[model samples]
Target: MTQTVGKRPAEDMTQVKLNVKWGKETYNDVEVDVSQPPLVFKSQLFALTGVPPDRQKVMIKGALLKDDEWGKSAPKEGMTIMLMGSAEAVPVEAPKNIPKFVEDLPEAEQEHLETKRFGAGLHNLGNTCYMNSTLQCMFAVQPLREALYKKASGAGGDPTGRLVTAIAELFKDLESGGAPFPPYAFLVALRAKFPQFAQQTQGVFAQQDAEECWTNVMYAMREKVKDEDGNPVVDKLFGMRTRLRLKSDESAEEFTEDGMTYTLKVNIEEKTAHVSEGVALGLKEERERSSVAMGRTVVFRGGTSLTALPPFLTLQMMRFFFRRDNGQKAKILKKIPFSLEFDAFEFCSDELKKELEAPRVAYKEAQDREIEAKKLAKKGPGPSAVATASAASGTLTAANAVADVDMKEAAVASTSAPTTSSSTKLSMTGKYELVGVVTHKGRTADSGHYVAWVKQSSDGTWVCFDDDKITVRTEEEVLQLSGGGDWHMAYLLLYRAIMVDMSGAVPAAVSEAAQPAAAMETEGGSSA
Candidate 1:
């Protein structure tokens, strides 16, 4: 039989006789279609030799038959076609028998760690990295953690509440160190709440804005959870207090300040290229027609200032912009330096500057004591042996001790808070340190890997949480995340204010609990 695809293979040969050998079996007087493609012989050989066409490797004398070749492929009467491959499919035996379940495993093989803290990786369901990365980043936030774990039934299986519940369930799975948990439930709930997310990009995968997803989930979570007194937990933790100042131009009788700051918009196109500079530049005066200050349509220049800073400050680097040609949110590959510590005093109004003074002095003293303690420890115990150790300011926002000098340089009032004999007043806070950073690895928000650089509260260690693969990172690595290429670029920066609590307020043993038990015991024994 000839299986000719359009044309025959060769002119001189047709229906030739042959002897075929596949394994131990030998088929005599086999007919070969030499005029057709050489592969067609495999089919005839399969009928007599019992070897399948795919399994049969036909060879005449020393030369093997190539597929679709006729004259080139050795074929003749009385030819003993030797087959090298097997007639039957070989059984694939696995090297080791794997146990299906943990319980089925041998006692020695079973892992029983007392506490297995899993650095959980999120399985990217299509292109849902934006949600995964954003969620992972915000998961470190104390308030969000509390709300998620203790989520109450609001809207009762409704889209918003379900989303919250799904997130809580996800956290539970992530806490365990076994498998990569897919965000299926949460995604389903997300699509329900916001149908726009269901809209796919890349022919079956949905690409979403990580920041937008973060905001939406936050909004829904905030809506779902509230305090007994009806105070929203999200608002208490993440809400910032902003006050704006404005000035009116000539021909305006009612010279009022411009409208208040409602939005957090930071542009990165700066002269010096710093996040602080971009934020400062964002506060520069802009023209706007005011109702009170401009009945005559006079020039209005307004500036925004933060009166009360939040416990956690979120600073978004304006790195992505719309590219008209590609119709995509293209990333700006500009290097913007990021600092661990942040100070908003320069961005605040002159009137508010007075409030930060007293805390500034106390924080500086605390820092000085810390430096003194370190120095004393190196020099063997002296008068500085009793130097107070600075503990993280608990609950209250504590300004960075280093930024305290900024206040003195600005010529702010040098007033100190009245300290009691028993304890110190540690209420001043404005300086912030990097808590977490949400970064992007690709050129656009719609198509890229999103990751989080989270700082450990127990120790000031920065960890890069890329999906589920968490790795300990250095301070230098975190600083280098400021954009410039195809690598991970810092997109969202979360800063936590340095908090300070005095030793007198907390018991020495309780205060030093984080220290090694032996060290704490030795210090106590020495003191006694």
Candidate 2:
């Protein structure tokens, strides 16, 4: 079936003629649709030149055509368009190979073949369970997994690029149905880049913290992995732009700064019982420093606010602390419960909240309509149902209308072309749902077993990845990971944004929300 892209219907399409010029070749009278989005035009160019939409730079009359806009200067009949992009050589499709007949094989061979057809686990190389667990959690990110596959297919020969390619290979092995295999090459590449992972004591590799390894691996990916347009893929998914505001009662000034972070570190305190409390504490802090405004030391209250939220959010629970007596990091077995659905609206700045309000309202209305439709569906078709069929028909029609809008928005979001603005491409609603988690089981941070719990996309059930052992777990059992005892407690939580049905047209609110954070410092020993 032919898919209709963009907001306009097929009947509204207005085709025009344009002359396309690439490197050394010029094609005359190419058909162009003026009614559709610019991305559609780029896709047509890709088919002709073998150049991906993200890599193509299409210019008409010296004005660049953006993925999100059609531009004020419209294309006319027989207009010349300049396209500059390198055409990538396409790989030929390979024929599938047939495996040996399972029925004629021995019982053990058949069993092995059966297990290989299922999702394969990772073999623990010594105390490498931490790495295995982290890998599993990372693989749970569908977008990241997809990106890794693309990188593996057409990656550079650099060390970081090799590392990504190796990871993709490992992931492919795991998914190809079979027994657990050692991620030897991936580990070698990782240790080569970050020597800290190769630490040893008495000729034996020592156990390391999973969070540290996770941080380092993510840092490497952020530095190396890029989309077709050469933008960091890691940052586009997991990075957040934050603003730190520091205020003091003794001074009439606030010092503010903006920075990027991949994860939010939540410090577990004595009074912390839930993850939300820890997150709240993580956003605010008190520090005593020399106040330049007062010419004396004074206490300052500092708070961090989200300037922009990414599609994926990572929260690291500070479960370990350095013990002064033992000189080792000890774990905090405090019981902290985290909700499946997290609302980050409260943590956002006032301006961001205002910007998110409309989208949130739209999402809530859509959900309510769905719920009403479900209720009507459950009522069944009887005499009573027939009595209110006309009334219920209206609700169903409205729900279908909302679904149509949502489908169009999803198409826009799934486009591979780069948008004019990154903020507009992000989640409209500051809400997320827990998808993947890394948990620890031991008392000390230095030596503990790590496990990954990931929600399967096919079925909403949770699966536990324990090194070479894999088990299906219920949602309730997964929630029990909230620490109260020595059992596995969540260490790293990955949340995916709950997508809101909003299109790129809503930019006024987004730009208004993106205004730079206010900052005021002592100017010439006095407030301005």
Candidate 3:
């Protein structure tokens, strides 16, 4: 004998209702879901009362609701909840699929954009989100995109070539104006590279590691890339090479060690709370028993020297571990706070600190220029002469550059560094801007829903790609994905170096240093 209850559609299964109350006012029914987490719920409340998520305090009876666990707090049928917080800003919807303006964009991005940021989503077939999210996040890297989609290019008959072709085909699909498609070709290319991914688990597609997929993608991209020296361009493109030192406990720097890493593993213990802290702690020294060295028990300390920084750097949160009780891999529910700007100055070796100096100077100068321009804009369009004089004299006005900028009739237009051969080589190492985040919402490594949150490089807008449903989100909501509870914990974070354009003008000293031969072209142009 068998019993069956009627199954609802996938849409209804994902959403639930809550009776919300704020003082004398009450919203008898409101629809929300765990799929997007409580941050979206707060956004919903913000819609109702014009209060921001960060300012609102939501409570059930006397108990307060945290962002990740709001699903558990809701009753099966539905329950009433209380809200407390002042309304700071008027209620407003975020940017939609079609944008309105470039008002809030950075000075460098104040121009017209052809493509909307993260306008398309990928189709998730079964438990294929693990692969989909990783692919979506990898698509955020500009160099990777350029390499894969450069016109009249074909991937040669190599293991990486197939993967490259698959990526290129998928990019075309994502960029095209239409519905999302299943990445069957990408899956085939992936499985061809690693047969284990093709294996069936319980007659279903087995979920694989996102980091492993990312590494394979990186390797494939590197194989297709070549340098002038005819060597692999892996390190120069996206590798984070490190220098390690192996020494006796009593002696310092007795032995040398060097290696390269594409990803940094954030080891978690019950004690650590933040991602940066975990990374700093993970770089600590270790003692091991060795057979070769006279100091049988050697103290090996790994000091990471940033020999080269790729356009994109990826960090993985070591969330899954082998649980002895379950006899299987289990997920970590630790909430590790990440930042929009990540500082890695403490982690860099002495030499790297010096290498990052020039770019830092260029960035500072560019920022100062923006600040001065904004100051002039605030004074209103009276004397464009004074602003032009200031620009020529290289002087910074006594005004701070805030987001509330009015660029109407400004003298100098802000821009980023030129696309020179060495542009990627130099950047502010300490400052890393968050570009893409891949999150998983499940208890085990074997199965779960994976989603990607990608930032639009043109404007500071975030779009969450959950399978085929693409929704724009706020920075407040994206920050909640940093992970504390079981909902959607950020598993991987991708960071890119922060570099500003010098407003279309390169420094005379650096320009001369960058290319001595290019100077001959300038003289020839003058003669002509």
Highest lDDT, which number? 2
Clash count of each predicted structure:
5, 2, 3
lDDT of 1: 0.59
TM-score of 2: 0.68
Scored by CA lDDT, what does every candidate get? 0.59, 0.68, 0.60
lDDT by residue (1-528, candidate 2, tens digit) is: 011222334454366678888988987877765765576577667546767676889988788889767877568877888999888756888667967677977774465564453367787766888899999888866556666776665666565776677788877877775566667667756765676776766535678888888888887777666666566667766776778888888885677887778888787899897888888899897777788888988988989988666667899999999999989999899999998877778887786677677767756765665566556667896665554554544433332222111111221212323222212232356777787899999999878799999876555678888988777788898789999899999999988766432443322112111111000000010000
Whole-model lDDT for model 2 versus the true structure? 0.68
- lDDT (0-100) at residue 361 of candidate 2? 73
Could you give candidate 1's per-residue lDDT for residues 321-350 as a string of tens digits? 898998988888798887988876787655
Task: Give all TM-scores, in the order shown.
Answer: 0.65, 0.68, 0.64
RMSD (Å) of each candidate, 1 decimal = 18.5, 20.4, 18.0
Q: Which number leads on TM-score?
A: 2
How far is 339's C-alpha from truth in model 2 (Å)? Answer: 1.4
Which scores better on TM-score, 2 or 3?
2
Kindly provide the TM-score of model 3 when superposed on the true structure, using C-alpha atoms: 0.64
Candidate 3 runs further than 4 Å off: 1-119, 150-154, 227-234, 250-253, 287-297, 382-429, 500-528
lDDT at 291, model 1:
61
